[model samples]
Structure formats: C-alpha cells, structure tokens
Target: MSNEPVGVLVIGAGASGAAFAWSIAGAGMSVLCLDQGPWMKQRDYPSNGLDWEERGLGEFATSPNVRGLPADYPVNEQDSDISPLMFNAVGGSTILWAAHFPRLTPKDFRMKSDDGVGADWPIDYQTLEPYFALNDRMMGVSGLSGDPAYPYHEPPLPPLPLGKSGNTLAAGFEKLGWHWWPSDSAILSREYEGREACINLGPCLTGCAQGAKASTDITYWPVAQRKGVKVRSGCRVREITVREDGMADGVLYYDEEGQLQEQKAEIVVLACNGIGTPRLLLNSKSQQHPDGLANSSGLVGKNLMFHPYAMITGIFEEPLHGRRGPVGCSFWSHEFYQTDRSRGFVRGYSFEAIRGLGPAQTALQGMVQGFIPWGEDHHRAFARLYDHTATLLGITEDLPEDTNTVTLDPELKDSHGIPAPKVTYRLSENSRKMLAHAVERATEVLTAAGAVETVAEPLMRGAGWHLMGTARMGRDPKASVVNERGQAHDVKNLFIVDGSVFVTAGGVNPTSTIQAFALYVADSIKKNIETLFDDA
Candidate 1:
C-alpha cells in the first residue's frame, strides 16, 4: 500500500467502479482502485474453447457459491427463494452477463408518488439522462430510436438481428396486440472503438471471446488506465477505518499474498454490488460508529431487491435456431411494465425473450421439469426440446422490504476470514401477483406463436443476476444511507456508486442505470470537491 494518501480510493473494480473511476480520473485527481479479483483476459474466455458450455456450467458459473474460485467469497443462499448471482473479476458480473442493457423508465424513480408502493428516489430520470447518454457513447448501446416505452434517446449502433427466435416471438406479440421491442444491448452489433462486431455466439453468459460484449475491462478500464488511474487486483478489503471525527481515513485489506495492509485515502468510494457493499459497511464497526460506518439510518443491509423472476418456456415443432444469436437479448414485451391497480398488483413486469439452451442444459432442465424421462426415452425427449423451445423471462419490479436482507453470517467466511454475506429473501405478495400475471400473459404469447408444449417455472432460482436497493438514496437522512449525490448520509467524503444506492428495482435491467448513477456521482463530486471533506 502507498504511504501517501491518494485523491480518491475506490473499492471493487466492477462496472460502477470502472465508470466512476474513469469519469473522476478525467477530472485530473489521482485515483486508485482495489478489486478482489484479477483482470480477465479476452483470450481465456470460455467461448474460445469447444467445451465452452461445460465451462459455463462449472468454473465460470455466475453464483460464487457454485463457482468457489479463490477470489470468490461463498454466499449462503439456503435461506433465499432465489440464489444471488455475480462475478468478482475486473469487469465484475458484466464479465458473465448477457449484455442486455435497459434503462429504468421515468415512473421507476417515483414509485411512492406514482404507485404508493415504494419510496421515491431523491433524483429522477431526468437527472441522469445526460449521464446515461454519455455512458452509452462510451460503453456503446445497440437499438433503434423512438422506443415509446422510454424517453427518446437514440442508441449508438443499430439493433442486433432479431433472428428466428425474435421474429417468432414478434408474431406472438403482434397477434396478442402487446407492446414489444428489440432489446437495447451493450453487445456491439457492429464494431466500435476498435472492437469487432458480435458473431452471434451462443454462450453470452460466459465471457465474450470476440470482445463484442462491452465488459468494462475492455471498455472503461483501458481508458481509465490511459488517463493514469491505477487498479490493484486480488486485494480483499476487510473493513473501513475511521478517525475521531467519524470520517473515513482508509481501508484495511488482505493483499494478493494474504498479507494485511492499510491504504489511506482522502475520499473512499464503494462500488461493490448491493450485497457486497452493505456487507462491507456492516463489517466496518468502529469506535465512532459502532453499528457500522455511514449506517446511522440503520438501513445498510435492508431493502435488498433481487427483481424476482419467473420463466415460461414453450416447445415448438420447428427449430427456431435460438442459440444462433444472443441468448440473453432478444425481443421483449412491456405490455405489463407499468402498475395497473385493476391487475391486482401495484407494479408490473417485463417478458424478456430467451433463446434455447445447450444440449446439456436442455437435458437437465427437461428432467427437472419432468418431461424427459431417463432409461429408454431420454434421448428422444432431449431431441424434442433442444432447439425448439423459446423462453420468456418475467423480470418483475421488486419493491423494497426491510425483512429481505443481507446480514453477515456467523459461521460463513471467505479465505481471508472475513464474514460472508447471508441472504434472507422471500417473494412478496405483490411480486407473487405480478409474477403470476406475467407468466399467464407470456404463456399466451407462446401459444399464439405456435407452441406445442408449454411449461412454467414460477420462480427462477438461477436468474437472480440483478441485485439492487440495499443502501438506498433519499433526502431524509433518517430513512436513507446516501443522499442524491451518492454521498453517504453519515460519512461525508465517502460515496457509494453501485446498485446498493438504487431506491427501487425497476422492471428492466439495472446495469445501464447503475453506470449512469456512477458517472453522475463522479460529476457531482468534481463540482463539490472543495467542500467535500468539510464534514470530516
């Protein structure tokens, strides 16, 4: 660790961290970031090998508990209805993501005023619009203009080819007269900023071999490094140390060789995801702040949002060749996105289309769904659903609930002996209603699109990729952990720029919005740099 204090110290070199680091470093301040995971190389991505599918199912699994890599800390998911999934590499979960980037709508920011379901965010959609646009320019988004579902903003590139899976799903949406649009993807449809175009590789959940998918390691980190920003890998931050003034002095971390070290910084920024961020705060107990630093509101690990998902799959007669294109981003319908009081639910969901699975996954899923029998007819059953199934994943709006939480487990700990996050989550009544409605509507779309056999999974345990709403933002210091500018309510000069700061989880994905929020916070910090440490 450096003896001299840096201008800003960022923890977790993930999506939000990379974006904020790049933006803040551009303001000419010496920025240094520390990540627990190593830098992922594009050449070593799973897609480059013939056993890509197997690798994705094993070592590169999305859930840290399943993967159990050296850099990963095991998350206790036994108590949760759905398992939390994330990656810890330089680009974070974006490394294993499908690149289906979607922005939260205007109504998402004002859930309290609009639907009376959740608390409203201090900042609205309009406040982050410019930052969203700026991030799209840097990260590169692919979609057509005039999406009516959102405020007008043209994507940087043309949409990816809908392929047979999307066209088939579009026919269903048209027949049902529902709202459907091509996904606005972070995966490049065409080459931009020296990256090559996507070649329609099947396994997007694994790392992108062609560098078509815009993981921050390839996109933001390179730029940030060029601007003189420094990032250290394989360093696990154990806790934050505070001074007598109750201000953040720096962090205590385990280095690459498992040696404990201290690094001082003038300002500390946390870009760890919802679970990780809150876990860190709750673990950082100090004399000045016993309950945890910046946790005076007693809401650090509360209000955890997983965006409860339900998947409905339909088996068709003809082959859709679904795996030929991007599996994660296809056409999706927002026919049930907004809150409709008459629908018996406060909020709604989005039916995002998913392509068919691989040979191994298809067989495994078929057996779990009780369709493919073993012994005699296993091959026959597997062949029927291999490339002939289309799935619609219902991404629901999960409201904040204090009961659903991320607490430090007493027994569970990482290799560094730091407490692991224990997730205790359950689906709320509103989520249950919204999920049922979405499944029914999605089944209709499948039937209209000529499905022969349809099966519904009300809860997708493996689909808990989007985590948000832990350390939420609000104007009232008593109710929130952070302010509108992403500054911690109790700890000035310390900021959070991750999904933990989301007030509510919208129906769509939160990645794009997370990046926008990070950039917005960096911009705000630059503007108030002089008075940033006054509270200290």
Candidate 2:
C-alpha cells in the first residue's frame, strides 16, 4: 500500500454524511468525517421557560460567530431576502428540522409512469423499501400503519400521541370522506432505545432539548463515533483532489484556523447536501476536467428542486395548546399524493395539520394581524390564539426541469474567498398547479374543521424545504452526473451521496430517501473497494 492513508474520507457531517460514515465504518473500513460546523451537544438546545433570544434557539443554535468557509462561518445578512436559512452545525439541518419523517409513497418513485410528467427514479420504491425500514428502526420513528393510500408500512415501536388538532383534523377527514392517517415522525413516544419519550414541549424546530428527535447528532453520529469513526469538525472541504489517472485521491480543505490542508484516501465520498455538493464540485477545477471535477457531462448543478409548501393558519375560538407537542404530529392527508391529470397538475401533494404556536410566536402572529401594538389587545389575542389556533401545511412535489439550477455567483464569495452558490430557480407550471390544488384542499379542510378564519400562503420559488435533483443519477452519462449507483460517471473513486443524486423529488421530506441512498451507495463501495484502490 502507498504511504497515504488507506481509509475513506467523508465530507459534510450532516444526516447523509454521518449515516454514510457510520455504515462505512461499521463495515470495518477506516473512515474520516469532516464537518464545517461545531459539535453541539443536547445541552446546547433551549429550554421551555427561557427567552427565545437568550436561549440561542432557531438560527442561532447552529450558526455561531466565526470566520471561515460557509459551513464554519455563515453568510450574515440583515435582510432575509439575501439570507438562506440553514444550519452550519455538525448535524446539518437536522439539528433544527421539525422531525417529520414521513416516507415517500410507491407512486413517488415512478413519476413518469404514474404522472406522465417528471422523470422516474432509476430505482423503484421496492428497491428502497428495505433501507427505509432500516432507517426508521435506526432513527426510532413513531407511527401507525394501515393507511389505504400507501403501501403497508412497518409498525413503529410506539405510536405518537394525537393532540387536539390531530383529533379535529381526523374528524374532519372522516366527515369529508378524505383519506387521513397518523404522521410518521422521528420522535420518541414511549422511550425506546434508551431515550426519553416526548414531553409535548414543542421545541423540535429549535433543537430537541429533551432528546426525543432523532437528529444525526443523537442517532447515527453517536454510534459511528463509538464504533471508532473519526469526526473532525470545523473542516471545510473545498475540492476533491484527483490523481492524473482521474481517480479521486482525497480532498483539500481549510481547517478551523483557515490553514489549507490536504488528506489522501483510498476513496472520497461527497455527502454534502444538495447545495453544498454542487458548489464543491463546481469549484474543483483541474486540467483533466476543466469545467469542474466530475463535470464531463456538464450536469453538475442542473435540475434543482424544492417541494413547494403552503401554510394555512386557522384562528380558533378557544386555546388548543399548540405549543406543547411536536411541530408535525397528528393528522395527515395524502389523498392527493397521486398524479391527477384532471387537476391540471402532473404531480400531487400531501396536507399535514401541525400543532399551534408558543407564546412568543403567538405574540408575533397577533402583531401581524394588526392587533393593538402591545398591552391588552396583544395579551387577549395571545391568550385566545395560543391553544385554539392550528396550521395545516402542505408539501407539494416539484418536477425536475433543467432550467432550475444552482450556479456560482461571480460577484459573491464566502469569507474564504470561494464563490457562493447562487440559486436561480422558478416554480414550473406543474408545480404552480399543484400549489393551487393544495391551497384549495387545505382551505376546504380548515373550513370543514370549523375554522373561524383561514389564510393561504402560496408557494414561492424557494419556499420549499425539500431540496434535490441537482447532480442527478441516471443511466445515460451524457445526461446525468452520476450513474444509478451514485458513482460519478466521470470519476471512478468519487461518489455523491445526498439529495443531490436524486433523479426525482418526491412529495415527502427527503431525509429518509437520502439516508437510504447513502446506504445503497455504501454497499456498492464496500463491494468494489478493492478494484477501486487497484485502479487508483
């Protein structure tokens, strides 16, 4: 063997990266994981009684005052227009995610066959079902199965409790003859796997202080670390260093102090999220591939997707106590997930009734409604809307189009003088139609549930959180960046394991699919490691 390290180097310590490292290390391969964020413990999260600003919750939990790559040092902007809300912490966005872990229906994979609109995934839902089950078990998801709209799901350890909103929505669904079921969430309901059950604290998006949510920091990362996987935080990988033969050697990154360092490995895996992965590939310029590393197909940053979300808020007459439970617990409507050409949309969407707001958030809502600037009216509004109000959020699927893309901004660069990823995206006609359908459905549900008032927010270009389909995987090398196995078509030892490899963006959240794809890629890497090293 050469003097260089004979292990795997994984980039981005988020869900996919952490899961990949854990799996690869569990397979007995030495693994080095790098994250551009800090290692945050559970104690760092906020408490219920603490002030929101003092608690350092929300955006402050992951982003700290630092100067380095985009991960270590966030792009600080006063205007929300210029800022992209993401975590720069070890667990990536999972640290602050709402922990809604719904699985994609079988129809999600074969969109072309079912919808005749977007492209189909190279692999079907059956091929990914086993991995999905594995992920649910590993993450300790809480849900009940037997929904007629989807294939039978594996039973959860303990079903999550349904709050008032859930019960009300369920009643409405039954009354209206619409399909509804309990949402699958990565939350503890009965204290399985040595973790405590949820206390109905409603702090999931701010980081679960009670440890009920299954972020990678609490799930796979700990197991990987215990199994001897080495994780180095504050390490931002800038480029994937390749040898003359076009095999990936390792990576070049800047350490915490902004010092440049390089590590050579037998294999290099890019687990960066949809945005970061394409940025790294597009920045790694070399003689062998001038456009970018693994850009021989020129499909590095095309087909960007985000699930268009529409939020419908309903103000009730009595307090519903929305601030107590998980953000996305209780009732869900997947009745429209299948493609209905009659609706004038190629794809479909799901409706989820979420819990109500906390004190501070309730106060903000009152302010938005032009309640008395402060004092009596504000207090009265807060008291009335605190428990009674409910929100039904829609996650609409977006079809992949070449025009939606992530490209380098020639004018903007991070602290390290590297170009930032400029997203130029627009909702497709299909997506617009889907959003309209979702709004109409949500309004009808709220009205049926006896909602006194309702307001609908339409889907904007970047409002959706489900990011995918950038460095897509397919059978054709000329049309896709990676093959079906997630191996870069232009490079042998390089793999892109994240939402960026998605050929299609399903209606559900992308975390479960991302983890399954990582597992699939890990299996391929394990089977071909010897040949890959020999080629290197």
> What TM-score against the true fold does each predicted structure earn?
0.99, 0.93
Q: Which ten residues in a row have the lowest lDDT in candidate 1?
A: 1-10
Candidate 2, 52-115: lDDT as tens digits: 5345433454333222334643332322121234576788888877778777777787777765
How well does candidate 1 match the true structure in TM-score terms?
Answer: 0.99
lDDT of 1 by residue, 40-114 (tens): 988888889888888998889999988999989999989998899999989999999988888999999998998
Error of 2 at 128 (Å): 1.1
Candidate 1: pairs in clash: none
- The runs of at least 3 residues in candidate 2 whose Cα sits more than 4 Å from the true structure, single-residue gaps closed, are 1-6, 53-84, 369-376, 460-462, 530-536
Query: Cα deviation in Å at residue 266, candidate 1?
Result: 0.6
The candidate that wins on TM-score is: 1
Q: Estimate the Cα RMSD of every predicted model relative to the unseen true structure.
A: 1.0, 3.1
Report lDDT (Cα) of residue 152, candidate 2. Answer: 89
How many clashes in each structure?
0, 7
